[model samples]
Target chain A: MLALGVAFSYTAGWLAPSRLSAQRIVDALQQNAGWHPGYRRNHAKGVCVSGYFESNGAAAAYSVARVFAQGRTPVIGRLAIPGGNPAAPDDSSPVRSLALRFDLPGGEQWRTGMNNMPVFVVATPQAFYEQLLAARPDPATHKPDPARLAAFFAAHPETGPFLAWAKTTRPSASFATQSYYGLDAFYFIDAAGRKHPVRWRVAPETADHTDAPAGPPSKDDLTDDLDRRLAQGPLRWHLLVTLGAPEDPTNDATRVWPAERPTIDAGTLVIEHAQDQASGPCRDVNYDPTVLPHGIAISDDPLLAARASAYADSYRRRTGEEAHVPGSAPAADATKASQP
Target chain B: MNTHPAFHPLARVLHWTMAVLILAMLFIGVGMVSTVSSKHTWLLAIHKPLGIAILVLAIIRLGVRLRFRAPPLPADMPASMQWVAHASHWVLYALMFAMPLIGWAMLSAGGYPVTILHGWPLPPLVPAHGALFGWLRLAHGVLAYVFFLAILGHMGAALYHGLIRRDDVLPSMSFPRREPSPPQMSDAPATTQASAVGTALPEQPPEAQPAGDPASPGQGDAG
Candidate 1:
């Protein structure tokens, strides 16, 4: 019976603390990181861009989603540094993120938020909450104590793999050269009535540029590099869909599937231009992964649903702040309304 | 039904094959729900393919059983015992069929594909829906408990017949009884070997008394 209780404590999401909701988790994260007013919630420092996704028609064989029908669809994307600080230096952060929205016909949109890291740190939302609490800064020092962090690792040994991954993964030179992974699995139903669980990753067409920087890195290093690259020509990435094997852990994003699994090169994503986040298409949009197209569905991974709720909470908090930030939200809306 | 001394060879083979498979499946099922270990990923891999195999084999067993007539119960046995023997066999068969289908449907409703190989896809048997998945999962879990209890009862009854009653019922489905010639002569005298062979082939036209009598000379061969 004690063993069963421990099993439920680690695996079952429903048995988590009743007071802990998506809003509460996000609020706790923001508080621990020291909240920055008038900034987007998690990935606060970001650049938005407009692009086109050209499907190779191969994705249609796996999913009947209209967006994968071998044509170019307008896409709004955002590149960001992970954390809640809007003014965090780009060179200081190792993990970067990209949120994409593929706007199909009939207002049907497929939105996904991905990070450069291959997997998430924790398997369950409750554990993630505990992680936030562990890393919370001391009231006097205003920084997390090393002792608290050590105790956290001791209690939750499952987090060791993610920490090792974070330590080993090198920072990318530019967002265009980084491969962003969708950490959760999604179900893709083909026309033949077969549903397969799949996870997606945007693999940069350009070779990795992980060599040491030529000069001292600045606060806007990534953004400057992205601008320089887009001026020369359109930047491209291949959206690869990997089929999950039965042995692959579908419910846990903290664990990754083996690299030997087969992957389909679904399509090419072409970035046309990069713009400031406050006045770009990605500002008003919330990249909720659960808002999928007809043929694509969310897998039973608990983290997927938790992520959707967290994104919703983040979206609500940011939008509610629009009244105070006159230059941020309304300006983007005005510019969009004036465009074709 | 009274003529055949033991079960058909095909029936016996299916019974033992299913026994091992079902026992393995039960352990895998218990292991899956008991913990949140990384090994569960591999356990799930073994479970889906094994369940499908059991489903396919159970259908064949049902067909083989329907085609062949089962041997009669001991003539001296009570009617209630006979009724229980008949009813429990049907229930066991029903559970063997129902368990796999429920598992398949639960996975389908949850929008998870039941694939064996990396590229080989087992098509969804039901549409993806959250509420249906919840209900199907609950039904699958409840049936698992019922199936476990039924297996215990089945094993208990088999032991009662084999050890306490010293009857042919247990051996009928076992390996030693299905051979063409009786091996009872190893222990019994050569003259009684003919009687042992006769008891083994009670399939003589409707003379149920001589063949199924538990107290006959062949009873010595049972031990």
Candidate 2:
């Protein structure tokens, strides 16, 4: 029976205990190829399983960065027309909308999916209602009238920053292939757990390009790119997290965080698997700024404040209830407020 | 009158097992995030297999759902709510399957081995050092949070039906019935990103100190 136990354990990859034995496994896995029969890399350094080098989406066991901070997770995201128009071409618009959802660790969640625009076309819910209404195409023309956009522009001057990005940043059908913004005043903790407000952006390994397809692009381009890219290689993103002191105006997100401050190496991201954009993950996920990681709390951005309410409403609209996520354990919360 | 037969026996088994595993997974997730890298020696050893277990169980549960039909909703439930319930349940199912797969995919993208029980390393599903891990991680973080909200509503609704409304919803999914009307996938819903968002070991807040402003939007550090 004991012999059977050892054999079963061996077959199951369970190695016997002993500092040396474990080390030997680590050493073997770490070997040029690795130590244990197949697992650890007995590399030059030995069986060092550093998160930085060898991540498994379980970074939560170490630090909080929603992406890596938890156990294995599944996700889905949706791209759609921002206006009431369900058929809006992906191209005719400057801003794109992404609805995202994550199933994470410890039953705690922070869900909020937003748009390409840092700030919304309007701040107040009332104003947003108006924007949604005005975004309608002219009855006479039955097409999206420039007048509607002009009026929305005239109504919400705060839309200036995002509008600037829209005007400056070229829109591509391959948006999933483009950079995505947290677009709010987001806080990120460094290795030491200190907080900094950042406007996070994901720079795609595959740069956005529309040179190939002629005519303004089509909304389907983003989908085309996603499929094409998935077939081709892995999708990579660089997580550039910005830092700012509390009350810093740049943290407002109405204005950009100055180019001067340095964004710590919070992490890198790679996505090998992807689901259909029209899937439930994208539709149900909420990217509200209010759902930021600890150490990375919300800034006093008005956009974020509106987002707090709007996103919850959005989730309810889709899911039929107020989101009551059993929030992840607070990160250094007492350590922050009490320490000061 | 078979008043409590909405969930199948197989569903019940998968559901309870998943519940225990999921809750344990969530707690383990919390513990994992709170720990620092240098200090997290043992907690991590558990995270891998547990995650692998979730993945396997989710696959099995999905297969069962596909192979066996889920008992229909109570006859009197609202059509829209029924649709919503179906949609939510499937979304949860999709997430369950994807999260663990993403973990494995991430490792494959990073060129790392995702061994089951530290045994035979699964062949790389994708290539090594592929950029997908980064985007997959982002997508994973984004969706995990949303699922958290979904679970909250699910639990609250079950409690509402079970308590306030005094409906049989709770018992149907709860115990002592032996009716096997358990949630097919079990309520093993947890958040990977939630803990990451909350329990990040505080880093030294970089004092507005400028270091060449690569921090500008669109201008990332070029390696």
Candidate 3:
């Protein structure tokens, strides 16, 4: 019985009392990948794009970051599907993601990775690791154990809202119509050194196009649709920031701030052109959200630092694979490169 | 057998106010669970404060009931129907008070603070507990359905009295008009209707009962 307990813990990735390392978490994510080697641990398949972000100067009230200055800043963005397999079909994934790097004046940069999901599934980094473990496929069945998943869910009641949301939220017909939300909170420091916690999301100007095709969606449906739409006009998303109220739970990404809290329209992110990652300017970029300009700093949210560490680990691993096999699968992999 | 003895002006006012608020609350409650859009946030803003309003008014309405006699049920009404009327009114009172409290406790157990008027926060009514939160949420939802059914039943009965029966039952708890009662009023009925109207009028002082004035609108009705 004691040995059985040890085996269960080992398989579940709860390596005793020590806090989970970034590598351990990333490895668990990779284990979820099906038939994909050296792919991004998460959101591997995506289309890179060129864009510019115009700040409305409203965000300046919360943060003294120069990135929020009222000007057009060059941007490299990637729209992605939520999965670890680079070759997975677009519609196979339920959540769509947006990762961006904004070039600022004075050689600084601001980076962010967002998802169409309003809230993340787990609250803490440990809980997230456990979730990955619970989702891992059984070696024999090649599917996650239903009993394990149920046990994990029962333990994490905080996941209730997110699970409820996933069932009801409609899949977007086009990337242009999907609103991308940053699942973690960050602290913005004003000139007075006062800090305010904020979470932000990009709301598309176009209404939600939730009418998914009745049948199997084409493999490149999102990318193809976005490219064709860009030919008509530039797609725009508004940067809306909700300031946290006093009782707002900043540490938990699963809980949403009360809607009545004041929101500031930070500006607009305009996607001008869609490009494949192969030769796109954003090809070599890593949108680690912790890479912030002045006046923006990490909050006490444990998930933020965990994400930063995991992103660093992912970037190094992917780049190492590239170095090992230069130009080997460039054409096939570039269109579905590790993006978010 | 069909007579109109107006409800106390306070009861009428409370009924109408609560009616609009409860309907709005039900829709907002439904909307809160159905979407994660910005509109959902607006619904919550209206939902929390509005629930508190209903809870507060239900208490005040119950307290005011002590000062006056409720109008009698129709002489020809079935005994079972009369019993349902009394039972449903108490159920409405209980549910109106309980829904907000349950919602408050549910949010509290879920570790969410209820916000009012901008950002004014209400203290949690219960400790944060997942199982308790789930149970309270389920209870709140179930009771809402019961509350809705009771409201429908109440409204149907009112319509039957007003439109089909042409009785004064509907007017008893609604805005009183100057029209003479369709059925001849007895002494007790006349004074009760007069007092109900007096309470309904915003300009009339509720405390202005004249000594030795049995017909004064300020005089409390005898059951």
Candidate 4:
């Protein structure tokens, strides 16, 4: 009875910080770096390595034995403009790209490539590139040419729903309440410890268009909106299962993951507070498929594999940085090892 | 060792190395901000340490400046222009040091971990606090923009000398040359004690300001 009470209190404390003063956090860290409670609740009701990363992390459960167990891991995430295009409109709803890094608690380190999009657009590498190119500029206009849509449709016929969502004017029109879909299908493990392919989506309650995408709002409206939403309350996601129902395993990304329903409620995705994702801290982050914990993986989604390859290439080319990190990486030369 | 008692070897070397480093840092900083990939993190890893190292070098450079006097300007150069150059150089030095120091301070204040390449973590030099960090961050950002502009002017002057005027001033300061000094026609050294400092032509030089001098009037600092 006493043990149950202690566990319940610890879990409650984990869910909500009764008090958040320097006094509370410092006291918590000193007591045990908050690990005593943090670890005990590592698999907290709805948490699955997502909390470690500000956004999402590699579900390293499949290959690496390093991050096999639970522990407080070092990680990072970035909020950025998506589509790899520098000129993309800033006001496109779902303000910034959140790339989460999870330094696994016990051993392995993984980084999950996540977005608000549950189902990704394409499955194969070739299709992925085709879609990406199609989404880019028109030679004459030198802007995101609308005619490229036909090329995308011709090459990757399965991007129906994705194109539908991407083409929706509301997302572009409404600046405040924007939803960013990872668009790429990834896998996840259910609370029952069963493997189920899933798509992670960041559904910002306040992210639709408070104003037009071209409104007089600052270019940082997306960031400001995200910050506001996070401050208001924990940002949440509706986990929709993409596998185990009618979705076939091993088929390329060209086909769809037949929807699974009743979509088992796996867990909630939440961002705690106003984490300043800036250039100094966020620039070196990666999104890899091999960074999962114990019960999730790439789901044979060619899109996941292709994304990993695309990200790795772009990551290496742009910054000369490696993407596949093994484990905990605290910045070097700091006298303060842990933040505590 | 040239026409004028130019910048010493150490000062010259530090100036050029910092220039290269700062240019690289700014380009990388700008590139890092626009992308969405692991590269962003990679660039930051470089930016943070390079920034810290620049701060250290700036400190050393400051001590050197305070301890030693820079060589006198060319006697033929205008006194007002020389004073402006001197003042601007000092401001540049101050900016060089302050930008990095403020960056580190901002990181410390914002609760972001500050690290050097040393195997150990950097000590939190400032007390960890949120609001303080925000102010420091704002200061660092504003100063970075200011520094960028200063660098632009500094480089513009250099390019003007190197490209347009075809003068040796830019090369002398930017790159090393150990040739013998031009023989002094006058008994006294230029820009010192009794020698005249202003151009022989008076305030508005009928010919022009020196090749390496700031072309604009307002840009001349109040020495």
In terms of docking quality, model 4 is incorrect
Winner by TM-score: 1
Sort candidate 1 into its docking category.
incorrect
- How well is each residue in A17-79 modelled by candidate 1, as lDDT tens digits? 444566556766677655554566678899998899999898899898888999988998999
Better model by lDDT: candidate 2 vs candidate 3: 3
State the lDDT of candidate 2 residue by residue for B118-188, as single tens digits: 22456666764323544554555456556555555565555555555443345444442443344522221
Off by over 4 Å in 4: A1-118, A122-340, B1-4, B35-41, B105-142, B156-223
TM-score of each: 0.55, 0.42, 0.54, 0.42
DockQ of each candidate, alpha-carbon based = 0.01, 0.02, 0.00, 0.01
Compare the candidates by DockQ and give the number of the best one.
2
Arrange candidates by TM-score, descending: 1, 3, 4, 2
List model 4 lDDT by residue over A294-326, tens digit each: 455555554553344334333322221122222
Worst 10 residues of 2 chain A by lDDT: A42-51
Candidate 2 residues A18-105, lDDT tens each? 3122222222212112111111110111000001111243333324655555233443344443432333455555565543334333
Model 1: what TM-score?
0.55
lDDT of 1 by residue, B1-223 (tens): 1222566778777777887788678767755543233334455668889999999998887677666655545544564675465556656777788899988886676444455543344677887544465556656666776776666667767767667765556666673343334533232232244345436545443333322222221221121
Q: Which is the leading candidate under lDDT?
A: 1
Question: For model 2, what is the error of residue A274's alpha carbon versus the real structure, in angstroms, after optimal superposition?
Answer: 3.4
Better of 1 and 2 by DockQ: 2
**DockQ-derived CAPRI band for the predicted complex in model 3:** incorrect
